[model samples]
Each structure stands twice: as structure tokens, then as C-alpha cells.
Target: MADKRTTTPAGPSTSLQRGKACLRCRKRKMRCDGVKPACQQCTKAKKGDACEYDDGKGKTRTQLMREQIARLEARVKELEKSSSSSSHGSPPANLSLSASASPTPFPLDMDSSPWDSQWNGIPDFPAVNGITDSYATEDPPIELAQMLLEIFLPHRHQVGLEVHVGRLRDSLHLPLGEQRHPVLMNSIYLWACYLSRPGSLCEHEPLYLSRALAAVNDAVPNPSKVIDFIQASCLLSMYFLSNGRLLEGSYHASAAASLAIQWGLHQLGSTDLTVGVIPCDRESTFRLNPAKDAIEQGERVLAFWQVFNLDRCWSVALRRPATIPDSKHPWTSVITPWPQRMEDYETGELEINSGSPTIQAFFVHQAQVSPVVGGFSTFAHRVKASALFEGASRLSSSWYPRLSSSPSFTENFRAFEHTITRFTTTLLPLHQLAATLPDEKTSLLLIHSLAHASMIHLHQPFLEDQGSRETAVRAARSLAVVAKHISDTDYDYLDPFIGHCWVLGSEILASEIAQLQAAWSPHPASSELRVELNTLLFSLTKVAAKFPLFGYQATKVQKLLDAI
Candidate 1:
């Protein structure tokens, strides 16, 4: 069969250049006026999210989204024809333009959203034949699906934040697609399988992953259901990253960001807060309606930050540019406030709703007063920390190789080091003030680890400087301290990215250990250094056993320890 395509919906006509357009235009078979970064057609159509040039390597982010959702829509269509499928169910809620006959454009104004019970009064309907339709082959029985969900819940933060876990748990009986959406349900299943490694249930990983992948775009056309895809994409991206699949991981990571943009999650509440957010859909073509409840609103906010955190940290992790640009770029402007904890939203304790430019403020050293640092929520800190790590990484030689001696590099270094100093010394209370649960403990460890690693990576090129080298030494020592605080249980709960994180400072530890071992009469503290090194290594060894994504990095870290 030939490829299916669509033209850009009609927009204001303007003078035509008649040259190459963006990959989005090319695929849509629209006329080309070839523009850079974003095309005029896309700009006018306000599809800045989908506008990107062809680098001639592979599919554009928009193409991937189209294909992913195309399959999902097909699946839904297939179910539509199934004699047994239900036809009475309602889509999540209405909000959007004529992007497709299926999804309407969102309005820019919040008060205008169709969120009242009058609009969404259609009662919830059970999915057709339960959740079985998501799978192409065998659908797991309800009993098995519940078990997998139980396995996933404990680790859902790593997949993507599940706002109102109780609600999710209670909704399991609602049928998979409506328990949220099949895309999200399947995404959780694959995570359960991945995290359940070495167990008999792990054998089902591929089945769930395939189903999850196929569900990618099912809700793209449904305004109310697109958040399901945004969230599932985030989970799927993390899954690939955990297994060390960088390209696909990066692909889906950006896909989540793209989906968020298309869904208007990025600029959520921008109009209400009067937060100078220039909408990606300038015409307010795809307005995100006010959420049905605070919990629902919290879900949208959480999804944006997860995508932001992934984009910021993983771009540095994968050594690529962030898909979510931080400049005042209208296309990618993120006006959403930093996220609050689930409890905060549930209890209406949303102090982080001021809505200034979050990433921008944090990077500009305005965090303390910028509403970002005000909320001491787990997610608030996590988001800011990733931005700091990304900021620090940008100054590292690893990100901009061959610029060590450049004047601009020297200037940027001071700012990066200053930010690290403020965070570690004044802002971030290093004490385990909030961590208790295994997951929380591991999360705090990851944040602390990233903070120290940021200093290490930034100071790497300045290793010849005594002060810079000692700063790195202190950071490495701090890494060991953080690692020791984590119990063995936290190892299973550790984020897969932390594996790469361990490799960062272990080499520094190895160097220090080697130096101490060579001394004929080492300092009394030398043995303690060895113990600290051993602690970090122990964590990595445990990690290697559990997470395949971390295995390669784990091996590298073990070799460093062995050589010493």
C-alpha cells in the first residue's frame, strides 16, 4: 500500500518562496517555501512543534508521532469494526481546532474550556471486551493485568508520574483503555515486565512493549485522550533508555515533548496566569481545557515536567541537544510552573503556580525567588536539578569539545561553577530531610549524585588547576557519601540513569584510590577512601545485576575499581 498523507489545513495566504519546506510540509505534501528551524507554512499554521528540517539521517519527530499514532488510530478503527466492541464510550474531553476531524483545536483562554460536567457529562464507559483489544495476539487476562499493574505501581515514578495512584488503582476495573488509555496501560505493563527482570513474568516483556508501541498515537486525535500518549511516550522513552537504546530512547523522549506541545500541556494555565506564554498554536487552535479536577490538572503538570526532566538530563546523558529549547523561542516556550507533589495537588497546596519561566529562571539564578525553589516537592527539586545538570554539562568539554581554551568557555565556566556552588552549599539541603521510602531515598540519591557529578564534569577541563581539581575531588567524595546512605533496597529502585551517573565519579575515586595505594606510608584517611570507593562499586555491582541498561556502564566502573 502507498503511504497515507495529509495537507496542511488552509491558513492565511502569503507570498510564496516556492523552495524546500520543512520535513513536516514535505510529508504533508504541502507547498514548500523552505524555512529554517521552522517553515513559514508551519509558523503560520502554528505547528511549530512539528516544524523541523531534514538532516537526511532518519525520520523527523513529527513523522514518528504520525506513524505511532497512525497505528493506534488504526487499532481503534479495527476495534470499531469488531462485532464485540463497545460504541458508547466518550473520549476524554473536548479541546482543539480542526487539526484532524478527530481532534479539535484547543482555545488559548482557560475560562473558555469545555470542562464543566455539562460538557463532559457523558459517563465513563467500559472498554470494549475489556483491555484485550490493545494486543495484536493474546491479551492477558484481567487477573494477570492487575498483577502487572501492582508490580508497576511501586515504580511508576520512573515510568512517569501517575497522579492519584489511588484513583488509578481503583480504576483498574474500568477496562484498560478507559482505566486511562490503552497506550498508558500498556506502557505501565512493559515497565512492570522490565522491572520484574529475572522473574518468570519477565518473559512477557516483548508482548507488552509491542502493544505499548502500537498504542502511541491512538489518542492523538482525541483532545481529551492525548495526555495518555504524552505520558506513555515518556514511559516508553525511559524504558528504552534503561536498556541502553540511545537513539530510540532519545526519539521517544522528544516524542513526549512533541506530544506535550501538540496537546498544549507546555503552556498550560499560561493565559490564566497571564504568564507571557506565546502559544505554539498562536490561533489558540489547540487549547488545553481547565482540568476536570486538581488531580487531573496535576497529571498534566506532572507530564510536562517529566518530559522536561527527561529532555534536559538525557540530552546531556546521550550527548545531544535538548529537544525542548530554553530560549524565548515561541515554538518551545514552556510556561508551566514547576510541579508540586501529588499530595499538594490533592490537598490544593499549589504554591508553585506563579508560572514565571521555570527553566529560564532556574538557569538565570532566579530560582530562590522564582517559584521553582518555593515548592519543596520531590518533583520540583528533581526538575530543577536536571536543569542544573544540563546547564553544567553544557559547560563541560564533553558537550563542546575543543572549546576548553575559548574565551566564552572560560566565562561560561564561572557561571556554571557558581550555580553548582549555590545549589550544593546553600540551596540543596544535602541532609536526607525528606527521603523515607525506598523510592524516595533512591530519588534523593540520584539528585545528590547528579549535583556532585555536575561539578565533576564541569571541572574536568580545569583539572590542572589545584582549586578546580580539589573541587572535583570533594564532589567525588560526596558521591560516595550519598551512595552509602542508600540501602540495598534502594538499588532496585534506582533510576537507570544513575548507572551512567555512577560511572562519572567512580573514575575520580579510582584515581584517588590508586594514588593512596602507591604511597609507602599513606595518610590514615586512605583506608576510608578505599571503603568509600568500595561502597560506590558495591552499588554498581548490584545495579549491573538488575538493570541491563546499566550493565555496560557497570562493567566499565568495575574495571576502574579492579585496576586500582
Candidate 2:
């Protein structure tokens, strides 16, 4: 080979050099032909737009991760400081003394409180119960807390626990010892844990719940903490109810109601200053000075409506007398202003002297004067409809059997029906057929479902009349249609209350089917009814797969269908 003419020396071997790759290539573990602006692999994969490179001055991925961990640890230490300080020594005796000094109209019996029994079966967390000082002083891991918060934010509005999101975020930035309300914080975490994805989180539900219970148990006896205590109790009530713990939920609900009354939330902005009047300057009868800022005032206003909405909704669900009745609690009838949007409070747009109309007057005056210009928010409208739904439920329960002889029942029913009809006609335009966004559509469907459900409930007791029977059947059909549409489409967002409407509507239809099948001769529309029932059941099963409570409901509906 040396003798061969100018044998070419072995050229440098063509080898791949381990050059720094673009971020996308590095993440994908691919070889990068390091090109400017875009890499070959990314371009070939049609992801050139996503291809990026780390500048020499920028930190590496590992370094960024470490920084995040450090921040989280700092937050945890802050949270721990408050707990550690409190646990190290007993709270001042003056705290209790000052609480007692305040004149509470209906004082809670601290000795034999109802909430004491409700906490029995909940397991104690070693960390929460102070088994070891170290555990008691530690805050929850940041990862777990973050996960829980993610689950809670989207669903809070559905349950009527819409606190100021901006304020909450800011609170997280403050030192742990400076956090505003421990009871509220614990309650928030408790519900977040309850709603977390199915796994170890489910096992920790009772632990968080116990922590909340302990906090509220302590806070209730202190007059200065009453407002925050009531807020926590209200959240706990819904949390229990959503988890199928009805008795505990009812107890907490009643407790919240009592505290709300004691704190004068029910009587806020009362026109008659003598009845349940808050201790404020007489000149400012229309506006209370209890709240120090717009955010606090907004929360107070929203809290009242939250409790009102729960009382009305659950009374119908449980078939029990409502704890806050309009006749006995004249404050319930007072025309307090509707709550402003959370953003308004955050931006300082809501003033103490803002002349917002009371919900009662809005319904009576604004609605009549400008039906199309409805001033109520979606939530406010939903609550208003809930009131009507509750009233219809109560009337049916009390007078269905005695309708033939009860003139008063007939008169009340007529008036209530008129009110509901007017309200339905006055719903916001966005809640009509014109809604375009997915969320708006879902909300519209919910409101309409509730309206129809209320109609079915109202007319079911009067089914002997052909007109009433037709109305019930029509409403039931409308509900089934909406439910089926929601399921068929990929509109996956539904509130807990929306599930309630589905179950109620299903019951009405199932009952009607059973009645028809029981008749001596089958009804002419039996075949059509069977088809509709099957369609509705299919929709329910599909939607149930998304929500745990709805899944339980679907199981019950399946059993009903099997029997039929």
C-alpha cells in the first residue's frame, strides 16, 4: 500500500462531537446539530418554534429547581413560626375575658356545645394534636399545600366560598406568624384536601378536617374572632355535605347561622335600626362601619348571602325547616345590597357609601323597570332562584296532602308561582340561549335546569290536574335535554349544585315512569317515556364519571332504572 500511488492517509474519522444541545433536544435526549434560532431535530419534528437554548448567564434546570425548593421552605418556616409561638405558651387569659365582656345576643353554651360530638370519629393527626412539639410546630409540606390550593380555587365559587383571591395570594407572601386568620386558613386547606385527586390525599381528609375543627372550636369562644370563625364554619358545612356527611354538615350549618346572627351579619344595613341593629353611628343607618376596608365589608356581605344560599338549598335537600326563616328573622327580609365582584373589592372600586340596591329592591324595582338590564351577577341570580326553589319545596311538603281544604296554601302557592314566573323572565341575557362561551353555556344550563326543577317540584303535588301534570312532565323533559347535551358535548365543568339538579330531575322522571307503569292500563306514551328515560340515564352515567358525588348519584339512579 505504501508503494501504491500516493495512498491517501486516513482522514480524520467522521465522529459526532458532544456539543451543547438546544433545550428541546436536551429534554428529548436527541442529538442536536446546534443551529442558530432553530435546531435540525426540532425543525424536522415541526417544533422549531419551541426550540430554545440556555444563555451562558442563565441558571441550569437543576439550579432553578433548587431555588424553588428554597422559596417553598422559607414559606413553610414562616407558617411554622406562628404555630410554634402559640404552642409554646398558653394564650393570654385576657383574650377570653375580653370576649366575654362583649354583649353577645345569643351566646353559645361553651360547656355542652353541639360541635363537640361531631368531632368524635375524626382521626387525630399526630402533628396536629401536639403528640410531639416538633410535629405540632411543623407546617404542611409545600408540595401538598400547593396541590390542595390548586384543587380548591376553581370550585370555591361553586360552593359560595368566594373570598378575595388577591388578598389570599398576598397573605401567602407575608410571614407565617403574620397570617390573618388561622381558622379560615385551616378550613381552606381542609376542603382543598377533601377535593384533591383520589389517592393518599383522601386518607388525609380527616386529619385536615380535625385541624379545622380544633381551630374553629377555639375561635368560636373568642368574640374578636367571631367573623373569621363563622366563615370557617360555613365552609366546613359545605365540605361535610359534599362528602356525604349530612349530620355533621347540618350541625356546622346551624352553628354558622347562630354566629352570623350574633355578629349581626343578618341585620347589616337594616332600615329599621331597632331590630337586630349593629352597634354603629345612628346617622349611618344605611351603611355599617364595622368593616375596616372594602375587602372586609365585601366579605361580610358575601358571607351573609353564602349562608342564606346554603340554608335555602339544604332545607329543600334535607326536607327540614330552614334555620333562618324570613318571617321570624325580619333581617332576612331587609333589602341589603348585593355583593360586588371580587375584582372590584381588590381594586378598591367599591366604596363604603356605594349606593348599591338591595337584592329585594333589585328584584322588585330594577327588574320591573329594566328587565333586560338585570343587575344581578350569575351567582346572585342562582341564589335568588334557590330561594324560590326552597319555597316551592316547603309549600309542597306542607300542603300537598291538604291542598283540597287549605285555602291559605292555595293563596301562597299562587303568589309564589307568580314571583317565580316573573323571575325566570328577567334572567340575564347571558343565561339565555345566546350564551357563546363554554362556561357561560354551562352556567345557563344550570340556571335553566334549576328553574325547571323548581317547576317540577312545585307542580308535582297538584298532578291530579291535567295542566299541573303537563307542566311537571314538560319541565322534566327540558332537564333531561340539557343534561344530555352537556354530556354529549365535552363541557366537563359542572358545579356540585348542578349535580343536585340532575338527581332531582331524574327522581321526578323516574317517579312519573313508575306511576305510569303501575296503572291498570299502560299509558299511550309509555314507549316514548321509556326511550327518554334511557337517554337521561345514559347522560347521567357519563357525567357521573367526572364527579364523585355525582357518581354516587348515578349508582342510585341505575338501581331505580333496573327496578323500573
Candidate 3:
């Protein structure tokens, strides 16, 4: 596969003399034009050095840090073994990314676990015929598709922020009853699930999960609604199951599965097209069904929850020495153990409402705030002038290189540029809103959103830039302060996940910044920052792994003792 590269400008001419060297020139250890994007010298060489991105080996923080640490440890072992000839020692184990303990040891085995029943154990959805045709027209409605383009076409970074923050509970001031927006409700549940801290299943699960489920129930009956409700229920059930609420959690999970099956069956026969109001021509240029997407997405969620529960159950079963021999207990002797599935954890690609006419309205409604636009409906229409922000640039032009050959690319790109200008220019107000939020939960929500966004942007395949790294680092610093305060207050639940997320995010961005540091020949002070960042990553990793709820305190203390 061709490697994705961020677009940079062409190089300058050899005739153009300048002080600052172009990146191409510098990489080749030659002269630079200092002209933005491209320089004349590199362009003249036909080097096509327009790709200014440093892939940086694309190594994740965990992978890079582990390799570095392993090398250091090997050196230490070599020295120690040479000094003491008559000693045998085992290598140290790698540290886990769970929680740590304080002076007292953390009890890791207090929670009960139950094995989740498979689909056959519960009621299964009866198979349906003629279902293939339903999935054939998997496009968004023309208007909604256009709207999605408009709202998301410009200021994609801001749009990403809206999508993510809208997922957390604190972002919306609407009461539980009033917070009926599908995007907001679904996002919050996912955020809570992603943000679970050590031992947080006791409190945080109930608060957010209950509220989210309520909002899901309040939404219009649709496939998306069923998926959201079922997914949230599964998360809550998993939390409850971990906390030893077997009967209650099992009942809830079972109910959720039943509902999901019904919805899945319904989706096979129906079309989803209700999020928009305006009618388009009968010709189906674009048609989208969020509920149908939800049905498939729900299955993935269900499988994940099942695996999590099954793993917990197996762990519980293995807590004590097994008396049964492999021959006697064949089920227990299954060869392959369940490892965490990475794909299930990241839902960035799910197209819940693709190409739907209502999606344009959705973005307009999302970007709407009181006084900034008239009423909610009016707010959506006003943004409609820009096609709700969708333009050509937001579309992955490179995915279909043929797009550039068509004149529409130029039109869409220009429109997208305008949309970007409008959205980016107004984001300061959103930042202001975040700055003024007094409620700790709300504040944490804002900070968490910012932190997640910064990290995501920094890691984006095609969009990783200095601005994204800077944004991530700054957000992490600010969020750390707020998280500290929240931890000290009644809103302690906000602290645990916030710290973990911030540390992980900061480490990733900081590592990338280190690469950029090489190009700028940054000052000694900046070098010091980079050094301290290494220490920060280690300390934060230790602290996050020791968190009381999810921290696996017993194992951590054991590792700490070994270190000492």
C-alpha cells in the first residue's frame, strides 16, 4: 500500500537565494529558500518533496518507550552480571498500564465475574431473506449528505471537537429529560466507557450510564436509538458485573440483547431517512440509514461486551489453582486465550449517519448556541447557506485521485476553504465557553474533549501538524490542572480518566514534537522540556496503573516491591 503523506509545498528555484533553508534542502544538507511549502531548488531536481511530513516511524508511545526501556535495562543487567559472576537473575517484567497503590496495598480480587451467555443461550434473531437489497443503497440522503459536507467540510478540527465533546454528558446543559439529541447521548456513553478509571465502576458507571440510557429512551424510536441504548446498557452491565452485581447486570444485559436483536431484524427491512425535513427529488442520489448502521455497530459492541465479560469470568475461574485435569475439563483447556481486541476499542470509523440529509441539520444544530443563531431550527438553516460546512476538501480527495480530474474538485475545495475560515474564526467563542464553565463535571468534559481532540489530531494520518501538537500539549497542561482540582473535590470521578488520557496523549505529542525539535534546532530550554517529558511519561504511567478502580492494585504493588 502507498504510504499516506501530509501535503507540503514544492521547493524553490536554485536561482532564489535565501537565509532559512527549505526542508528538502536541509534533509539533503543543502541550501533553503525559506519560501513556504516548497522551495525552488528541490522542485528543480524533480524530487517532488511536497510531502513535508515526518512519519517518525509511526511508532506508538507504548511501543517506542518499551524498546527504549528494554535497551537501558539490558545494559544495566550486563554491568551487574559482569560485576557479580556467581549470580543468576531473571529479567524484569514490563510494567502494565493499569493503576498503582499508595502506602496501603490495593485489593484486586474483590470483584465477582460472570460468564456471558452466547446468542444461542439467549433468544437469537431469526434469519431473514431478501435482506441483501436493503444494504444495497447505503448512501446518505442528498440534502443530509450535503449538510454533513457543509458543517464538516470547513474547520474539520472544530467539527471533530463538536462530535467528540458532544459525546460527553457535561458538554450539554440540557436536563436529563431534555438531552434527547442522538449524537450527544451516544457520545457521552462512549466517552464514559473509554474513560473508566480504576475502581470507578462503583460510582461513575451509574451516574453517566443511567443518564445516557434515559436520553436514549427519550430519542425517537429508530435503529440508532436501539443501538445506543443497547451499547450503553452493555457497558453498564459490564461495570456492574465487575462490581459483583451479577443478577442485576445479567438482567440488564439480557434485556439489551433482546432489544438489539429486535432492532437488528427491523433494520433489515426498513430505510432510515427521518433526520431531515426538506424533501429532495425522488431520485436517490444519496440515502442514509443511521439505524441500519447502528444494527451492525451494535453487533460489534455486543461482541466486545461479551468478550470482556467472558475474560473476566475466566480470570475469576483461574484465581485459585485448578484441580481438574485438562482431560477432565475440556472446555477449560481451550488452547487460545482471549486477548483484548484492539479494533473494538476504537470506533472512529463507524458511519452511523452517513450521507443523511438530516446530518447537515445535525451539524447546524450542534454548532448552534443561543443568540449566535436564532432558534435551533433557524440556526441549522443559516449554516445551510454554506451547505452545513461540507465542501470538497473535507472529502478524501486522494482516496479517489480521479476527483482532481473533475471540475467539481476545484469548486468543492474553494467552498471548503470558505467553510473552514468561518468555523475556525469562531472557535474562540467555544474556547471561551469552556474557559468559563464553573461546574467541575462540565469543566472536565471540556478538558477531556480538548485532550482527546489534540491527541487525535496529532496522530491523524494526513493532518499531523505543529498546530495539532501544540494544541495537544497545551490542552494536556491545562487539563492536568483542572483534573487535579476535580480530583480534590466531590467530582473525583473526573480526575482518574482525565489524568490517564492526558498523560497518554501528552507523551504521544511530546514524542512527535521531539522530531520537529530536530528541524528547528530548538534552544537548550526546550531540550530540558523534552528530557522532563520523559520522566513525566514514566511517572504518569506508574500513577495511572495504580489508580484504585481499574488500576489492578495488587499486581502493581508486587511490581513496585520488585523495583524497590
Task: Give the lDDT of residue 222 in candidate 2.
Answer: 68
Q: All models: lDDT?
A: 0.64, 0.60, 0.34
Kindly list the per-residue Cα lDDT of model 2 for residues 283-378, writing each as its tens digit.
Answer: 433333356666776677678778877787776776667887554234444344455666566666542312233444543445456433233666
> In what order do the candidates fall by lDDT, top score first?
1, 2, 3
When summed lDDT is taken over every stretch of 10 residues in candidate 2, the lowest stretch is: 93-102
lDDT of 3 by residue, 1-564 (tens): 233334555455554443245444644566655544445665666444331312233553234333543443344345435434533452212111123221111123434222232323433222222122111222212332222222221221111111222223232444534433443343333233233233222122232333344454454255434444554555444444433334444545555544533333212211233221111234432222432343243333333233223222222222211121122132222111111112221343322222222223223343344222221221122223222211221243232545536688555544444443344344323333322212323333433333333333322322345654554455444434433333222232222323334444444435545555666766454554454444434434444453433343223323432332
* Residue 48 miss distance in model 3 (angstroms): 67
User: Candidate 3: minimum summed lDDT over ten consecutive residues — where?
Assistant: 332-341
Using lDDT as the measure, the top candidate is 1
| Better-scoring candidate (TM-score), 1 or 2 | 1
In model 2, the clashing pairs are: none
RMSD of each: 23.4, 14.2, 26.5
- Rate residue 71 of model 3 by lDDT: 47
> Could you give me the TM-score of model 3 versus the true structure?
0.30
Q: What is the lDDT of candidate 1?
A: 0.64
Estimated TM-score per prediction? Answer: 0.69, 0.67, 0.30
